[model samples]
Target: MKGMTIIVKTVSSWIKVLVFLFGIYIILFGHLTPGGGFSGGVILAGSYVLLLLAFGREYAEENLPLPIASKLDCIAAFLFIALALLGFIYGAGFFFYNFLQQELMADCNAAGKLVSAGAIPLYNIFIGLKVAASLFLVVLVLSAFRSESDPTEGQE
Candidate 1:
């Protein structure tokens, strides 16, 4: 009653999972593929946006509350900064250096492994989280606003 019909809700529920998975895939394999943190984060936020559209703001808020999203955004930012600064502590002597790559270089051939990119993947993960949370918050806030008469009522 508060949102679209049951058919839309059910379909959105199913599709959201796939979208979320695709976003994770993009974030994880971004170093190898074209899509990365920013694109994947947008895709991730879009999954929640689809839910909000199909199930209403209240339902979406219940699943991912504003406070939790806010905290996630902040935590992700801190982690990204920490990852960058870790290079300094590890004698990389530069911000955003590939410190992990250096250590792994002596271990084995990292030609096609997941850990090959090292800090890049970590950065992507944190960046993906931050972007997803930020975009979702924006859409959620925008969705909260509504005119009294309803925008669709007086239209043809």
Candidate 2:
């Protein structure tokens, strides 16, 4: 009684997976590609927003509880900061310097390899997670509060 039609729910349930996967792909390959953490994170949050719209706030919250999302958001932020700070200790006097890349560059074929980007991919991953969780939390919180005129305001 709370969500959209059955057809919408079914379609969204299927499509959300693809959306999520695409977001991950973007985040992972962002060092070589145009789309990066921010864009991919928006896409990831959009997948959950689709679920929210199709299945209602209760169902969406059940899928990704506020507590879990909040934890992930905080953890990702901390990890990102830690990773940046690590550069200060290991690099040539800079933050976010690619120390790992220097080690890998010894190999002639490491130029375009997935792992060759060193800290970039890790940064992208953490940023993607943080952005996705933050955006989802904003949407979920905004949707949680019912308006005075909501039809279900007094319902059990």
Candidate 3:
């Protein structure tokens, strides 16, 4: 019902930050590489899951409560939609067209650079946030139900 041993806690304390950072990196560089929003989202979700496992459900909930997770999930999705819709204004009515395609930057269109991708990084970030929150919320709710339904909460 609670967290794991001290070793797990210590290792995870360091690992979670690396994983979270990697998740963001994946999302940011998704367009050029293989990973994308979905993969990065799953990775981000994994970071929260790591926190839950290492710090217990109570701590996880304190760090990312259900209400805040739900609100962030919805907001991220809405922001993604709004951003996509903005392409219509600059993309000639296209759904997800690159509005910032040819603004004459220094070298954004280079083959293998972080800023080469237009709107893709933003999309990945939003989707990653949405998915991370949704996954955390689901896991937390399920764990709550599981804890409540357990037959040995206070029997010991």
Candidate 4:
């Protein structure tokens, strides 16, 4: 299956970019708002899923090939772990010890500013990356089951 109709492809083309950007916004400003890494990550994955649905498996894979997705998955996992390890070396000898200082304002209120969030935003970004890549890969691989089980579903 290549895709649905031109309407779906066009609408999804616009929606996917917006969804991806909104996911980034959520990850970046998570500490300032209610949303966080998990939510943003789901949204990000949804954008790719939208692509997969609108353009089919092959098109989505072409857009984000397996090698690239795998590399991203590894990089994100390593970076997230390395970030946590920093707490042991630089923090109070504990894991995730909030080593980074929160940026305070002149009035002594740093509640919702982007810089005021300390390592939370960085953590959110890493989590978002990892979650997105992980989910994308899972969906991609699970989709394989559909074809393998039927054998003639995608073949004409």
Return the top candidate by lDDT.
Answer: 1
Considering summed lDDT, which 10 consecutive residues are worst modelled in model 4? 101-110
Clashing pairs in 2: none
- Lowest-lDDT window of 10 residues in candidate 3? 99-108
The order by descending lDDT is: 1, 2, 3, 4
RMSD of 3: 1.7
Model 1 residue 46 lDDT? 93
Query: What are the lDDT figures for the candidates, one per model?
Result: 0.88, 0.87, 0.86, 0.83
Q: Which pairs clash in the backbone of model 1? A: none
**lDDT, candidate 2, residue 73?**
97
Q: In candidate 1, which residue ranges exceed 4 Å CA deviation? A: 147-156
TM-scores, each model vs. reference = 0.89, 0.90, 0.92, 0.88
> How would you encode candidate 1's per-residue C-alpha lDDT over 1-156 as one tens digit per residue?
168998998999999999999999999988888999999999999999998889888888998999999999999999999999988877458887878777655585466676567688899999999999999999987777652346773563
lDDT of 4 by residue, 17-100 (tens): 999999999888898887989899889988998998889999889988988988888898898888888888777677876667
**Model 2, poorest ten-residue lDDT window?**
103-112
Model 2 Cα displacement at 89 (Å)? Answer: 2.1
lDDT of 2 at 4: 99
Winner by TM-score: 3
Tell me, what's the RMSD of every candidate?
A: 3.0, 2.1, 1.7, 2.6
| Model 4 TM-score, all chains together | 0.88
- Count of clashing residue pairs in every prediction: 0, 0, 0, 0
